[model samples]
Target: MQTALLFPGQGSQYIGMGQDLFTRSIVARRTFEEASEILGYSVSNLCFQGSEADLTRTDYAQPCILTVGIAAFRVLVERMEREPVYLAGHSLGEITALTASGALHFADAVRLVRFRGMLMRDAQKHKAGSMMAVHGLTPQVIEKECLEPEYRGLVVISNLNSSRQTVVSGQVNALTKIKERFTDLGGHVTPLQVDGAFHSPFMKNAAMQLYDELRLIPFHSMRYSVLSNVTALPYPNVNCIPSFLSEQMVERVRWQGCVQFLMERQVYNLIEVGPGSVLSNMLRREKLDACMIQSMDKKEYLQKLIKESLPKGNRAVSYAHYLKAALCAKNYNIHGETSNYLKEVAGPFRELEQLARSGDVADGNAKALEALNHILDCKMTPAIQRGGILSHIAEEGVVRHV
Candidate 1:
């Protein structure tokens, strides 16, 4: 199956999330433990015992939600032997997606988001803005209304969640003034419980601060493609990671576009891996009949996915084997700095090749992709040459299976 994994952002978090997974799975427990050590707070206690108000605080919510999402993903990775073709996240969930894709270490991601949440919370204190969800209105109508003289430069669409659901963020007064206008236009305006006007110009200062933090952190090449909420497309490359992620804070989350991109790429299975069913519900609203949507939140859902293992002789597995052989036969010649090539490219490829031979289709596919990413990151190879190799691998190793 051509599968895509989705991660939920803030507002999807709730107390007691991931408790069952923590109790039932060692991998889940360890993930939470690792995050806690890095964060210097018990994420497990926060999720399983903290009050709703505490969990709702932006400073506390971001890391907590990210930890739970990563815990769930680790549990799934341990139990299921399937590699998703793409990964996407909503708002704060984007960091979770990057972490899962191997672009960021879990420790670095958790610390970065915690700092992000603090900056956003401080921004809210300074500017005092809010957000509201507008339902039953087309984005065009909402955009036009936001452009009205009374609200222009104050209110803007923050999240394009779906065709019928959009979230607006701005100064409190601007949202208040527009709510009545939207109500009169047959749109239901529900105030969101967020602290600040996220994904709007209100977050400009915070985004800049986040950019500095992002620069200090190291980003790795991703094993799987991660869709950027700011662009609603796969991230272009690691060089653009910090800037794109910083821009995501003040730019509208093009979730609807991200979904469209996935569907256009023939993703038939969509799994929401996080604390709540928010993303899954949004996907359902899209009415994609050809897509099979599943959410991994509770223990039962995890069990169900584990039980649905792929049958033997699947095309994905066969393709992975072919990829392994092709990789083995490929030349590793480079123009200069052979040491960097050996360290960054050849060494990782050797390890991934061994993983591909381990008889687990999921591991094999994931390793093959990681190996490809390593090769692409080799600066010794020309960009055009690397692109050609990637194209060849995709055509031979992936296209036929789809």
Candidate 2:
């Protein structure tokens, strides 16, 4: 099974995200306890009991998410049949991926992200700004809107999450203007739940300080191909990671391109090993086959699914099942009662229904997994073949034609 591991950024955090793994897995408990000592505080408490406001702070959120993300990965790693072929992360999650790939030590990573968050908080304090998610708009239209006379030089596209979802970040006034204009243009605009205007020029000060901190940490050669948010491609060398990671603070997160890169290389099954399903939702919205396993239970389900699907030395074909189901749903709008057969067959991917209904807004974690299971031992239908969505996917990347 060719797999790419994804770690989510700041907004993916929740109060009791890693508590399940910590309670059930000794490896996860050790990872969290080690992180607590490295940061000189109770990271476990911040994740298990902290309120929304506390978890939203840049300093607390970055480390807490990183710790939980890495901890969850540790618990799941022991059961994996193979290591991931690639690793990618969004915003601060990139640091976690780096640590997982052996590019950065866990202790150094926790401390560096903490310091980086503090510096970013300082930058945010000096220059007040905000971010807004503008959906149903192309990147060109959004960029054009940001450069309009009234908002020129103040606002920029901070995150290219998907073809239809772009996030804008800048001064409060500029954000307000863009939000109003985009909404009037028949687009959906929602303010992001963040403490600062991340991935924009507003973070230059933080970027500068973060570079210095990055230099102090020793970086080793990566064990897997790691994609960068700033470049939207794999790093040519391990040496470029530190500077590029620092620069990521003030650059656009080219997430859409990063996912496309993985698909182009045939890395179909992108697994999000963290708390929330944000990245998975974006992948589904783009019609890319993806799944998430955040807790110990989900990890066990994944292992069982893989075992059940690829018994007796069969080459792993679970990813093909997932891709077929996603294509079938997209092309046929196969849902409700018509998809009941799918629900019964999709032992692992039963959650695909919710994902198909909500797109990127779907909050369920098991949908993609269940969809994968449905097609594991099943054959493709004639309708899916005639639609040619899967053929189009092969030639032009993962997004569905319809």
Candidate 3:
């Protein structure tokens, strides 16, 4: 079966969620433990025993959900001997897929996620923005209604979850206005339990922070053809991924595009590797093929999809994957003397940083890193390995090695 792994983002999290798997499977427990070591906090405690309020914090939620997704992914890898033909995720979930596809280390992925949440959270400035799901109609109708002219720039379809279902986000006035439009447009609207508007320009500042994070953090080439939320296709060029990820924050998430692309590519089996059924539900609705949609919330998906997602060679390892333990045998750095684009990345990032000043510290860190990397112009591995002046850049967020 040509399989694809789908990861769910923030809204999928729930209290006392991943405990069952952590308790029952050694693979699951090891993954969680390793994540705790990387993050410098008790991630497992938050996922297993923490209250909703504690786990729901932006910083915590990013890493927490990723750890669970990774934990489940590890178990799947242990059981399955081969990787899938495709991979994707919704919102923050896309980062999870990027990590799984060798574009990032699990530790760095979690850190970036923590910052992703914090920065995005601060960008809001507490205007009481929120999201709601509208179903039972075509995206065309929903868009026309939710995006009526009077509510211009107010209510926008944030998460295009599927062809028939999308989540709208924005101000209260805009949302109420959009809901009326949805009602008139023959679409059903259900207010989501979320607290902020995401995926719209209102979250533009958060997207700016995410752009910064994209710069500072490194991205690697995909082991397989993974869909980009920015373009809804295999990343056009690995070198241009920073912009793609940065824009994904404020740009419309082309989830329907991802599903359609995978389906057209003949991927019959799609796995949702996370803590909920949300992504899977969307896939079933969007793709009518005998689409074997599975989720990490259940044991079956963990066992089945991991087998489907990993390649013949890159399976579970005999060692723990802590950042310190996982460095390359040779110390290599790009030294920033090679490319001009590395320098060009600065302009956009500086713009993002200006927008992020009132936001979280993590937001600043993310943007600054993006600018630094753009100046270096290579994948993170070489961009950060350079010494002297460039070594200064690597220390932005890295936990130093002794």
Candidate 4:
């Protein structure tokens, strides 16, 4: 199936977000550890045990969310055989998408986002703005209202989440007036848990500072296409990455457009690889019923993917059977020492046979190679004889099956 990966932004974060991925997958654990080492703090601790108040801070939340998104993506890479055709993120998630696409090194991306978060927080202290989600309103109506004489120059639509939902960001007073206006027009308004009016003119200074940070970091060619939140299109070239990323802070997130573009390309499998199901819920709201959507927010979801990706049918069993027969046919005691044969070859082969019978392809395949090593290590077996057995096993697809 053609798949696209979507990463969630700041509001998706919470206490104990990535704890499951951290505990269950070594790749995920290493990703968190690597971020912790680079940031000089335990990202795992923050995601798995930090308080909600601390996690809500832009400086902390941005990095924490980025770490979790990338951790889950890494675990997915380790477990699944298929690769996504496109990648996209909501807000701070765009950075996560970039890191996962290999356009930005994980270490550099971590420090850059921490710096970006600090800049945004500083901007919030200076300007003091907020964001509110306006539901049951079309983008055109919200845009028209923002351009009115009283609300104009005060608030702007910051997020085009869907046909039914839009987010506005601006000064506190302006947002209050806009919220009242929107509510009177039968629109439901809910305040977002954000520090400043992100993706609006209030973040211009932060965006400029972020541009300088982006300049210092080197961006590589992406392994897969990544859609920009600012343009809702695939990045045209590597040179535009820094400018487009910086511009994203001050431009509305065209998430609805991004999803539409994916649908146009016939990409049906949408996987949200992050801390929460916010993106998945958003897609559902868009009413893309024909698409298969999934969220890797918990360990159970990751386990499901792993199970589905396992080799199917009797190929694994057949390989296991062939190996067992070969091992039994081989004489481990060419030197006439039966004790070495019993300890080395017999024990490991028995374990491999049990794994094969259990029908766990991954484990059985792993144990088969390990058992082969044991068989080759028997001191009583002649070196020439061992080579002959190894060649025969290779011919039987032992290595290829794995």
Candidate 5:
């Protein structure tokens, strides 16, 4: 099966991420250095060793997250040398994925993300807006809740995560009302740690500024498929990418539909090449068949997934799976030998009911494994460090045992 590479966006960043690779991998380290020089700031220092507050700022978070994601990506490609048939990114990550596909230069991509963050952050300077997750409720229900009488004109849908889960954004009071309605409907609701009502009309001003910056930047044709947020379809050219980048802020993040489009195109394997497995989690929920999904944000998970994806002839996949089975041998509770997970990834929890039925998929583990090799390159890991801090914190807080 052909492979697909995915990149995550804004919501994934936290302090002290990409810390291990920054120190361990020379290629990963160079990505940080290049980013720092291009941005005219010590972003690598901030990404590897800055404080939470410092890393969390929009200006800092934008380039910082992108750097780590790209660093992990470079390590993956350099190591695996696997070519993907298509590329996709969520929100801000779209630009990163496009660049990885040879659509844009790395430096131009960084500049765009920097300005993109600045514009989005400035848009809500005076607005006390927020986003809340609505679980077990359809997008229709939550969208209706926002426009009810007192809360009308305040709330709007921001992230269409899946059929069963969505993130709505609006004025504080409107969001509160929506959350209350969700609770009463026996749905789960949680608040997101975001600064503004992103991906909504509230970001119209941000779109304007980004449009100006996008016009100044140059874009090149993509080497592979690039699914866009505005179209919820594959972007065929680079000429229109700049405008789409800005317009996306004022548009809805049709993530669920995006996943559907991927599946329809037979993209069985998916890799999230940035901090956190948030996007992978969403894809897992939406996949009908149990498919291969991996993240390159950390070292452990991606390594495990890539090891799982190799062709039967490729000894690396066999060896890795052998190791996992051998190490976790005590937990299987079976006496006879297994096929080294030859069929599919065995796990519980598909998702919640119909939403899960349509959202979470079931498939063979082969595609999933292959995708890992496409963008992760062997050095990147999926395992998250237990006590690792964000880059800002790692810089100042990590102390030697001595």
Candidate 6:
């Protein structure tokens, strides 16, 4: 069955979120290291060891969560053999989805989100605003009440989270008034613990700055369809992604609508591929059987997808190429020079490619498969090898060395 990958945004991060993946997967560690070099601060430190206050800072939080989310995603791809049929991310996660789909390169995504966070933080300096979650009400009711003239001060619906859950953001006074009104109307109102009025006009300045920054980044055509937060629809074209992302800063996250869009497309299996079960919880509330990435039964789930996604029949050469591609992708993600231990396994990787193209189908397949097994089993450092999270081989029920 086809699946859709859901990535969470801010408020989903916590200490040690992706540490397990980083410890277990070479590709995950490389992603963290690459981001650390780009930002000149240890993203791994911020995610794994930083104080809650430090992580909550807009500038720090965006990059930290993005890095962790992407790290988990990379590790997920390495562990599983399936490709997602569609992608959707909440707020900052939209960028993550783009990065995962090849629309934005990893390095470019790290830089862009850092700048985006800075701009949003600066916007808060001049405009003091707040966000509140209004539950037990539909979008129409919340939007109508927000527009009522009595509690006027720039309040607008910020996130359409679900049919019965919507968030509002704007000036504090306006939000307070709306909260009181919603409570009196029997709606549950919980003020969000955010520093700025995100997804509202208060973010106009940040939106403009983000737009300017987006122009400098090259967004390639998406490999998988990504539902846009601003439009609540699949992006018409990749070229439009920049503009949509720019508007996303001040546009309500039409999450409910995005979910509806996915549902209309028959996406029943929605797997959230990042930290926290927030998105999965939200989807479950919508009666969808959504699953999170870091489950205890991850190996079983990973194996099932791998069996489906792996090429079949005469695709032996194609499978060989996939292994090489995975290796090269991991290579680009490495922080410093290749380690001598990894270098020791490079010969087998090279041989796999050679054997695949040698035109002897039977011998080539056997050699390529054997070479892959050797490469995956090659040893590295003791520290890298001994981790709480170990990749598994379903067939042998043994820990994979990769």
Better of 3 and 6 by TM-score: 6
Total backbone clashes of model 2? 8
Q: In model 4, which residue pairs have backbone atoms overlapping below 3 Å?
A: none
Worst 10 residues of 4 by lDDT: 393-402
lDDT of 5 by residue, 1-402 (tens): 556788888778776688776765555666788798999988767876788777666777888888888877765663343456677788878888877765566788888888887776777778878777788988877777777787776888888878768888888877877677789988998887667788899988789888888888755445567888888888867778767888888888887878878778788778788888888887767656746787886578655533442223211122233222222322221321244232212321111122233432212222222322222211122212111211112233221110
- Each prediction's whole-model lDDT (CA): 0.78, 0.71, 0.65, 0.78, 0.66, 0.70
Off by over 4 Å in 3: 38-40, 300-402
TM-score of each: 0.77, 0.73, 0.72, 0.77, 0.73, 0.75
lDDT of 4 by residue, 1-402 (tens): 788999999899888998877775555676788889999999988888898888988999999999999878765753454568899999899899988776776888899989988988899886678899999988888899999999888899999888888999999988988889899989999998888889998889889989988998876556668999989999987788889989999999999999999999999999999998999998988889789999998557777864543344332234465356446555533533466347646776677677667665442353565455445434323334544444455444433221
Per-residue lDDT tens digits for candidate 1, residues 172-233, read: 98899899999999999989767889999888898999999999987766767899999999
lDDT of 2: 0.71
Please write out the lDDT profile of model 6 over residues 248-362, one tens digit for every residue.
9998999998888878877766777777777877777766644332331144544454344333233223444535433643222222234643664678777856765764433
Task: Give the TM-score comparing model 1 with the true structure, all chains together.
Answer: 0.77
Each candidate's number of clashing pairs is: 0, 8, 20, 0, 37, 0
Q: Which window of ten consecutive residues has the lowest lDDT sum in model 1?
A: 393-402
Instruction: Please report how far candidate 2 places residue 47 from its true position, in Å.
Output: 0.8
